[model samples]
Target: MEKKNNRYSLLLVGLAVLLVVGLVFTVGRSKKPTLNVYNWSEYLPAEIITAFEKEFGVKVNYDTYSSNEEMLAKLSTGATGYDIVVPSDYAVSIMIHQDLALPLDKEALPNLANIDPRFLDLYFDPGNVYSVPYLWGTLGIAYNKTKVEEPVTSWEILWDPKYKGRIVVVDDMREIIGMALQTLGKSRNSTDPAELMAAKAKLATLVPAIKAFDSDNPKGHLLSGEAWLGVLWSGDAALAGMENPDITYVLPEEGGGLWMENLVIPKGSRNPELAHEFINFILRPEVSAKLAEAFPHGNPNQAAHALIDPEILNNPASYPPAEALEKAEWLIDVGEATVLYDQIWTEIKGGR
Candidate 1:
């Protein structure tokens, strides 16, 4: 009886030991740090994240969004836990204003010098406090030359009777309205309620001509010949031109919209130091050059520019002429006036 009792006791002790060991193992694995990043779809080079993970001994959880508003809605919910995000210049301002961004620790980012000072301290995030500029480009029309009778040099061509039912523009409200405003000799960032109304009225006229308002893949329509002309970003234009040589990108004579993409750390970042490290890694000359090769946008890194082919820099559609650069205006947030912007945009898009 005594021996049997001892065996039972020994078995119970062994079970407790095994349970403790299992808990320890699980805890160690769970403690391994990770970072969560949310960025625009098709924005980053493929292997940049992989390289970052390997170099830092950290795991990266990456995701993508189609538009700045989509990202804002998700981030505002406070459950996504995204540590790093990339938004355009105006979106960065909105994010900063809404307290969605965390102040960047400059010491962690040694490569900030690689970015052009000219791009820095713009109306958005002055002194580069909350964000770092990523890629810069203009909005323009890309069309299939074989299908288009003449080169499209004006935003009005998007509404031409000949191209009706064969045009796609970005789904962004600001961009669509800005295109009309520029065509009408108004500023892209005009805060005047009257000018916005005029822009809205002009856009309403072009609504029937649009096949679709697609921000994600407008180039697909042009490439597939479903739509011969599109209001497309320079990167998408570059991709379409590569897919078929018959495609051509044209910057409007009226000075189309200009924008900058930026990298920012979210307020609740679990790994701010790691996020900064990754940002610096992306800013590296060789790294930025590789990104430009894959994405084909105007990289703001001077060192990267030196590495890329001169022809890419010389591409008029991507870089634009010196005079156009001087005339272009950067977008800024109008604060409480967004309600007006939204109302006009909704009215135009919802009319038909």
Candidate 2:
């Protein structure tokens, strides 16, 4: 009886040791951190994410949204666990004002020096204390050469009755209104109620002509011949031109809005250090060049310029002339005026 009891006790002890060992191993394996990133649709190359994961052993949970408002709304709820987000210059300003973004730790991002000085210390996050410039481009017209005989030089072409049902505009409130404001020789960031009303009136004329309002893939409309002319980001226009030689991107004579998308850590980041590591990794010259090659936007990293493909570097659409940039205006945060914008945009879309 004593021998049998000893065997039973020994077996129980062995099982307990095995269970503790299993728990320890499981906990150790689960300790690997995850970095959640929220960015624009089709913004980052897949390989970059893979490379970062392999190098840091940190899993990347990347999610994409089509607009700044969508990203802002998600983060504002404070329910999401996004560690990083990309927002446009004006949106960055809004985030800063709302305390939705966290200040960047420059010490962790030593590669920030690769960014061009011209893109730094701008109206949004002056001194770049809270954000890093990722990609930049202009809002302009992209037209199919075979579909339209007229030279597309101005925003007025989008409102021409002849092109009715063949034009596509981005489904963004600020961009569409900004274009109208530009056409009227006003600031894209104009807050005057009278100016906004005038812009809204001008946009009303385009209602009948717009075939579809798309922000995700306006290039698809242009590629399929469903849209002869489109208001598009320069990078999207560049991609369309590459896919179909008939597509051509042109800056309107009246000038257009210039925007810079930025990388920022939100206020509730779960892995702030990891976020900084990822930002530094992306700012590397080689990595930034790869991004420029994949997205074909205006490369803000001066060091990446030498490594960029000549075809992309020389593309006038991707890198507009100095004069065009000089005339361009960055969209600034409009604060409470945003409510007015929202009302007008809703009215326009509702055909009110």
Candidate 3:
């Protein structure tokens, strides 16, 4: 009886030890640091995140959204615990005004000085108190050299009836409507009902020319030879050109939209320290060069230019001349004019 009682006592001690060890392990894992990053789909390189995670010894929960509006919706509703977010152009202003973005710690970001001065002090973010410009590009025309004979310098070429059924455009209302407005010599952010209505009228005519409205893979159409010419973002155009050397990208002489996607910390971030670290990590010239090499966007990190391939850095489509941007306009929040923008898109797309 004594021997049996000792065995039971020993079993209890071992069980207690196991429970204590299990509790400690569980708590340690629970306290393990994590960063939640939300960004545009395919905007960030996979290796970049891996490098950050490896360097920091923390897990990064990366998520993506297709549009700035989608990202804004999740953040503005306070539905997410996202630590880092990338907002573009006017979306930066919207998030700032809505208090969705928190001020960045400049001291934590010493590498911020590496940014191009030309990309800084814009109307969207004066002094960049709340955001850091990450990648930027322009909306322009991409055409097949073999298929297109006419000069592709102007937006007017898109409206030519000869190219009907061979042109593709981004599905976004702002991009399409913005093009029409720019073509008409009006502001892309035009709030005037008359100007918006005029753009709406002109877009209806373009519907016949548009073979399809695809934001996801407009390049696919362009590469497949289904689309001879269409409007595309500079980064997408660059990618398309790689797949098919015959494709040529040009910034319209009329000046199209210029957009910059920036890295920002949202309000209520769980890990502000790590978020700042990640932002600073991205600003590192080598890392920025890696991102530019993978994404082919207009990198704002001037220091990284030396590290980037001359082919990408010198590509006129990817990096247009300064004069092209002199007349370029950054798309901004048109206030209530978004209603008009929506109506125009709905009316045009609804008919189709």
lDDT (tens digit, per residue) of candidate 3 on 1-352: 9999999999999999999999999987786799999998898999999999899988999999999989998888875889999999899999999989899999999999999998988999999999999999999999999999877889999888889999999988888899999999998888899998899888888898899999999999999899999899989999998888899898888898799999999999989999999999999999999999999899999999999999999887789899988887888888887887888889988873
Worst 10 residues of 2 by lDDT: 324-333
In what order do the candidates fall by TM-score, top score first?
3, 2, 1
RMSD of each: 4.4, 3.7, 3.1
| Candidate 1's TM-score | 0.87
Residue 118 in candidate 2, Cα distance off native in Å: 1.0
- The weakest ten consecutive residues by lDDT in model 1 span 322-331
Which residue runs of candidate 1 sit more than 4 Å off their true CA positions?
1-31, 309-311
Q: Which of the two candidates, 1 or 2, achieves a greater TM-score against the reference?
A: 2
**Whose TM-score is greatest here?**
3
For each candidate in turn, the TM-score is: 0.87, 0.89, 0.92
Put down candidate 2 lDDT per residue, 63-115, tens digits, no spaces.
99987888989888875889989999989988998899999899999999999
User: Which lDDT values do the candidates have, in the order given?
Assistant: 0.85, 0.91, 0.91
After superposition, the stretches of candidate 2 with alpha carbons farther than 4 Å from their true spots are: 1-30
Superposed on all Cα atoms, model 3 deviates from the true structure by an RMSD in Å of 3.1
